[model samples]
Target: MDWMRDWVQAVRECEGGALGTVLCLALLFVWYCYRVGCEHASYTPESRSSPPELSSAKLRPTLGGVRTGGGASEEELNGFAYCQSPECFRCSRPGNGFNQRLYHNLQDYAKRYTWAGMGRVHKGVREQDRYRLCNRPSIQKAEVFFLPDLPSAPFFSRDAQKHDVELLERSFPALLAEFESVYRTPPPLAPGWKANSTPRGHWWTFYLVNQGTTLALNARRCPRTWRVLGQLRTFISNNVFGNACFSVISPGATITEHYGPTNVRLRCHLARLFTLDAASRGERRLRPTAGPERLH
Candidate 1:
């Protein structure tokens, strides 16, 4: 009974000590937590400045006004000036004002007779070529006209007549032969005629007179020429212009540089004769003179 009592007392004393230790430890822990929390609350997050609000109306500027200079001017900011601005006009206008006006007027005039339908046979040519032939989407039947310098009067009596390729084929061969005979020999290699040195081979060309009345037959007289003309007619009816011309460029022939009167015309070369290695091949444009005599 004495041992039992002694063991109970010892156990009670140990339990009491453990309880006190636990209470002290818990108090220490609470103190540490409270200190950390108080420190965190004391260090409030640094206040941040808000970004400036942009006005929607200020995004695009008025036409004549200068832009805010954050870096470049708005015109400079966009990397290019607006097209309608007077500054843009001043910068972008062509150097030749008179020529520009003349060109614009000529374009307006050309719109009246320009073909609006797909080109008759050369439609399959390159897009660039087609554009050169006619600016419109398709060539209409009544817009064909002859150059005024032709030996004969204009052929078409009225604009109502449809252009027939068959007739052209029957007539173009003689003209081809004539052109061939005259241009067959190798072209001159002189400085002024540099385009004459390229190798050339003969080829035929037929034009559909969309607006003209000049019969293909009117251009020829001989029977053999008529046969050649017939071939041209057949090709035209079939809508084949890919192989029509025989192109030849002299070895070193440099065609002087000159822009066509309008962007609608494409130049085609039929190679009838050529030299193998002469320096006269292809077209070249001469530089314009700096002074009043601009011989280009």
Candidate 2:
């Protein structure tokens, strides 16, 4: 009992707080070393006896040839070349089934897009605008669009006239007069628009409603225009086609070919306006603006 009491006194004199702090620091140091070792193990490379799963199994003779002088591995000796196909195995080889069909039973035709001799000409060193137009016979000759099915019984007979044309005819004269009134005091054309104009003058837009889908502005001043639009509101939703305007392109004014943000709806042009709707190979719709024309 006396020896035990002496041991306890010795420990207290040695300072137990210092001992505890040292032990805590030692533990933290060990943990940090363990974390560093784990990180080192992750980056270290390991040699595999077999190739990666993504690599092809079989190989043939390639023009790149065997490793000439160095002590190379089996993979290095087997030179690789990529044919113009995704399923190609042998690189630089004469025939690795570059144009092979996936299913033997399937029809022999261009199933999807395949690279068929593309030119790689960068304009500048950095300008890498690649254009790969599909010139496949199967793709080009495919019957894509079909005519809309119609009923034998006609909705309107030969004598039956369109109501829309009649409505336009009724409102045309009044609208024309109002347009002349608006034209008497036309707003100054936007600066950028004048430069882009083909006639070297300016193309103007008289907005009945603003481009934004809110309350109709400037439509109130033109009552006749508003009434005609109200009659057609049943056909077109106010929420959708709110922006209505009469674009006045002068005799030589030519707006460049362009596309709107969305192609959900077709633009409604009332009069003799030259319009060309062409879809690119990428399915992007290219819109041609009204060319220079004499307006009556």
What value of lDDT does candidate 1 attain over all alpha carbons? 0.33
Tens digits of per-residue lDDT for model 1, 3-32: 999999999999999999999999999999
Query: In model 2, which residue pairs have backbone atoms overlapping below 3 Å?
Result: 81-91, 199-252
Off by over 4 Å in 1: 1-95, 103-168, 189-247, 250-262, 266-296
Each candidate structure's count of clashing pairs? 51, 2
* TM, every model: 0.21, 0.33
Judged by lDDT, which candidate is best? 2
Lowest-sum lDDT 10-residue window in model 2: 124-133
Model 1 RMSD in Å is 29.7
Residue-wise lDDT of candidate 2 within 76-103, one digit each (tens)? 3332212233322222221213122222
Q: Return the top candidate by TM-score.
A: 2
